[model samples]
Target: MIEIKGLHKYYGNHHVLKDINLDIGEPGIYAILGPNGSGKSTLLKSIIGLVNPRQGTISVNGISVAGTHAYRNEISYLPQIARFPDNLRVFELIRLIKEIRNEEADESELVNLFQVESDIRKRLRNLSGGTRQKVNMILGFLFDTPYLILDEPTISLDPVSLTKFRKIISEKKEQGKIIIYTTHIMNLVEELSDHIILLLEGRIIFKGGLKDIYGKTGSSSLENAISMLVDKNGK
Candidate 1:
């Protein structure tokens, strides 16, 4: 559903992304794992057109992402750190997000999805960090876009809420949505990803399904398997 070809990004003398090529298929969660400074965030930003690559091309559903807002409507992204107006109520913030996306969201649906009915009137600043993360998660899922890019989405989320969020994502996957997730948590990657893309020194060293990783590492556990890959290929 998404293709990135020969992508390259640089910061002065330092190269961040190097000749990266990726094909992300639909209906499955793709996990991107890399050490810090390996350009995982840079790759995500490039896909969203927030960071322009010095080389290569990105296309989504047969449309080029060079200079168009049309492609933006097809995807939703959740950054690692999300900040909202401290004074805005939960419902008000959600309403604002829906309006910004030019979407007519179902309030009750969101309330049930995030279980925010009782908390809707509370200010964002008064909410716990986990609840704030929930708000961000709901906003990312609100529009039901075809492609979702989530970075450290489980951070600050309570175990119950994380489980609920996982269920929601699983439902989305069953519906054939494309998901790209980035995180340091190996366990979540094992549970959620069908394909794993490992980035090392600004380039992809491994790209294949989880089963392929298992076979390559000769490990039964996904975490142990990925640890092997990371240890071998990551810097």
Candidate 2:
């Protein structure tokens, strides 16, 4: 389980996250939604121990994220943007990450899943944006961690790959792992998310299922509910 309490963060007089509190205990997909500067990335980084909060506590399972790096082994991250040396081939990057992390991986299976075999020998500079994203997906999913954090994961994906992505996400849910992701696609959220966390400015204004949002905002659809909520909050 992931638990957060009284979280606050700032950056040179700008408050990024405010007194945020949350709990994620179930095994399902949870979408974190808000506008561009709503602190979604900050919250995610905080949980992964990449960003520290001035005041608060974050714990995964029973381990605190304050000063420990071991807890991160339980999480696999798919960054929104990944930068790599253009000279490296696709497979070389995979091998390099596995060596750096010094953890067992099943990347061969993932490569097959994404049908990225032909491009494995191709250099990073040679791949298209969507193909590069496939490589990113393979690297992120191969670790088989209990917690997966994906930021803007579907960006630049082709339709066939997108379909495969959804299928794999559903499979992950069935395997009883918690998947946390951020995306602007409402239809994707409606299709995959078991719950959602909405942030306004630096605070979490809402956290619940789709039906709960509908009830709270008196709106019938997720898109309308979010629009109403953000507008009501003066965003």
Candidate 3:
């Protein structure tokens, strides 16, 4: 389980997160949604210990994120932008990450799933944007971890790839892994998320199941409910 208490973060004079208290105890897909600059990325980073909070505590399965690096072993993160050594070939990058993490990985399944097997010999600089994104996905899921955090993971993916991505996420959820991700695609949220955390001005304005959000906003669709929330809050 993940526990957050009194979480607050600041960037100079700007407050990015404010008094965030959340408890995630179940294994399912959680969609973090907010408009630009709402601290969605910051919140995710805070969980992964990439960003430190000014005053707060974050723990994963009873392990504190502060002043510790061991907890990261249980986490697999996919950033919004994946930057790798351009000179390295796809397979080389995979082998390097495996060697760095020192963990057994079933990357062949992922590589086959993403249909990147043919390009494994190509250098990172030569792959197309979509292909690179596929590679990013493959790396992110290559390791079997208890927690997965993906930021803008569907970016640059085609419809067929997107479908495969969804299937992979669903399979992970079924395996009892905690999946936390941020995406602007409401249909994807409606289709995949078991719960939604709506952030506004660095605060969680709404946190509940999809039906609960619709009921609260009196909107029929997830997109409309989000727009209504934004309008209601004047954000």
Per-candidate TM equals: 0.92, 0.96, 0.97
Stretches of candidate 3 exceeding 4 Å from the true structure: none
* Residues 34-150 of candidate 3: C-alpha lDDT, one tens digit per residue: 998899999999999999899999999998889998988899999988888899999999999999988988788888888998999999999999999999998889888999999
Return whichever of 1 and 2 wins on TM-score: 2
Candidate 2, 1-235: lDDT as tens digits: 9999999999879999999999999999999999988999899999998888999999999788898998888998988888999999998999999998889787888888789999999999999999999999988897878999998889999999999999989999999999999999999999999999999999998999998999999988889999899888863
lDDT, model 2, position 68: 92
Say which candidate scores most in TM-score: 3
Candidates by lDDT, descending order? 3, 2, 1
lDDT of each: 0.85, 0.92, 0.93
Give the distance in Å from residue 137's predicted Cα in candidate 2 to where it truly belongs.
0.9
Native-vs-model 3 lDDT?
A: 0.93
Candidate 2, poorest ten consecutive residues by summed lDDT? 104-113
**Deviation of model 3 at 11, angstroms:** 1.4
Q: Which residue segments of model 1 deviate by more than 4 Å?
A: none
- Candidate 3 least-lDDT 10 residues: 226-235
Residue 190, candidate 3: alpha-carbon lDDT: 97
